[model samples]
Target chain A: MADVEGAVLTARSRVEVDGWQEAIRASCQPLLEAEAIEERYVERCIEMVEDEGPYVVVAPGIALAHARPEDGVKRLCLSVVTLAAPVEFGHSENDPVDLVFAFGSPDSTQHVSLLRNLARALQADLADKLRTANTVEEVESLIQGIVQDVKED
Target chain B: MTTKGNPEKRLKVMTVCGVGMGSSLILRTTAEKALKQLGLEVDLEHVDVSSARSIDADVIIGQAMHTEEFEDAAPVVVTISDFTDVEALKGKLKEALEAQGWLT
Candidate 1:
């Protein structure tokens, strides 16, 4: 109940990056700019990918970036980043990721419920359509649909 | 009976990730489901990667690059590049646990 909710994003409509760090940094900009999270949280997310390899791709094209709240978190929020060209997160067998959803939660318990909703939204066929979307509006609409679904549930 | 072949008792497992929020949770869910299907009742813990070096668990599952960070702390470790396929994940984990005499 920190008054933080999910936001639909159009900022990551056309991100092209060489590495996983760049991809995470580029994608999480919207959340970082909105004061949705501490500045270091962005770096922490990138560091997670760098140190652990890319395990963010929960499903094809969609990747969720996160780290511990204790690292630096002021609010509970969600931001979406959709890449123009899918970038590799070091997972050799899986396809490159275009969607990077960043989360900033205040606690572990809050994170589980929030993440569960996002995962369910992304694992479905609807997320597949959003992955190949051509316009920012298309991406925004897809995120809107998912957020609404989460609210309803 | 533990699928790990250790009839003595089933092993407790933990999966740590960067923040224990996003990908880590997903991995935990997948891992728990996979272990259950194999008849292994693993106790999965979601710990932040930063503090993983301090937490105590029977076996730690996480990204390969981070294995070294917890190598000294955890007795058993299963570094996974991908958990998208549960069968492949179980196979790798089985091998690790078996080596520890926790699995058959």
Candidate 2:
């Protein structure tokens, strides 16, 4: 997993979007601005949702949007977006997502390790908490808290 | 060994995501957690949904979007929506296993 020592959490912790597409854009724009990924990566994420029907919605209220690295990735990055209200991803199993997480990597392997670390945080109810957070700092604190717990463990 | 001669053999479970990184990894973790809660240890595989053709697992666990990809390859397919819900996942996994005679 990449080092989180100087990592930053860039999320639209609280925002309202008209629909899932907006949600996806909002979630990934931060990574785009940070130069962690190219605009095409964000577009690819949307295209995937349009083609695959929101399969990225992993949990009832969480959507982890991403695309192939070759689509457009400059660096490894993650962005979180929490909608003011839930938006349907048109899937029966994992729809009505209120928290969207967009991620990017230079390749599959690097993303896997990053996700492995994220899994630890998510398994600890990180997404569930993100639903109610009102600020990006709160989101950062939640993620940092996970890092602290991991270190303690 | 195909384990065909033994009735106690475990089933192979596979999970897939579009990139085999983001959603797949998340669901994989959730699936493992559910398996642990069920107190059943098993072999699981993860793959990119695009490469999901002719998989070798007895059971494949993934989102509903990938169900069609394994229409003829796998013997059992379990599609999930809420990977975070371990209780639901355990119930579904048990059902999939029992349906395929992998669970008694």
Candidate 3:
């Protein structure tokens, strides 16, 4: 499994965003700051939503934003951005997402384990804690805690 | 592909997403657990939507939005609402397998 400590680039809680696009951008900001992905990566993710609908909204209240690795990924990294107010992504079942997870991988397969761990973490109560977290540290710790728990399993 | 519960024949199950690396992989994980609980053995792979359309599989599972585009990709295309819900996936997969006579 890809280690969460290395894959996680940033974690922010209760962030204010205007809409789904803004929320995605906010989630990608840390990846950009860490030079994990280029600007085109973020644009591609937005364009994917525009072209493909809101399929990235994989679960209720959650959106996973990503594009092809060639779009512009410098390294493998993940970002978590929890919205202060939930925004609609046009998904019928998993609409009005409040938690956005953006990730960039150098290739197609390297991040599968990371996503597996992440999937397990999300299945836990991480979403509820994320919604109420106030600081980035709190969010990071929460994620780390869950990822650690999944690792033990 | 062989439909009966033959240990020699493993069904090809493909899980797809827009990019394939993210949500689809998660769906694959959930599907793996679901298939195990349902006492089914199958080969599973995750692919991007574009690539998935070109590949052949016995069953294709994906989000409702993406699976809508894969109507002709497989014998059975399953739409999953939640990628992390094993019970939901198990129920849906059981239905699809039964419909195909793959489950007895």
State the DockQ, from 0 to 1, for candidate 3. 0.72
Error of 2 at A31 (Å): 0.8
**Regions of model 1 farther than 4 Å from truth:** A1-22, A32-35, A38-40, A43-63, A67-72, A88-97, A119-129, A135-153, B1-10, B68-76, B94-104
**Which candidate model has the greater lDDT, 2 or 3?**
3
lDDT by residue (B1-104, candidate 3, tens digit) is: 35766657789999998877888888888888899888987899998889987888999998877888878868788998888888888999889889989886
**Worst 10-residue lDDT window, candidate 1 chain A:** A1-10
Question: Each candidate: RMSD to true structure?
Answer: 4.5, 2.8, 2.3
Which candidate achieves the best lDDT against the true structure? 3
lDDT of each: 0.67, 0.75, 0.85
Candidate 2 per-residue lDDT over residues A101-146, each given as its tens digit: 8888777666555566677777667876887677878887776675
Q: What are the per-residue Cα lDDT tens digits for candidate 3 across A1-153?
A: 554446655788888999889999999998899899999999999998999888899888999999988999988888898888999999999888999999888887667667887787666666778888889899888766755654576
The CA-based lDDT of model 3 is what? 0.85
DockQ of each: 0.28, 0.64, 0.72
- How do the predictions measure up, each by TM-score? 0.69, 0.86, 0.91
The prediction achieving the highest TM-score against the true structure is 3
In CAPRI terms, model 1 is classed as: acceptable
lDDT of 1 by residue, A1-153 (tens): 223244323345666777667777876677777776788988988887677667676655667787768878776767676666777776755558776778777676766655555555543455667667778777677766655665666
Better of 1 and 2 by DockQ: 2
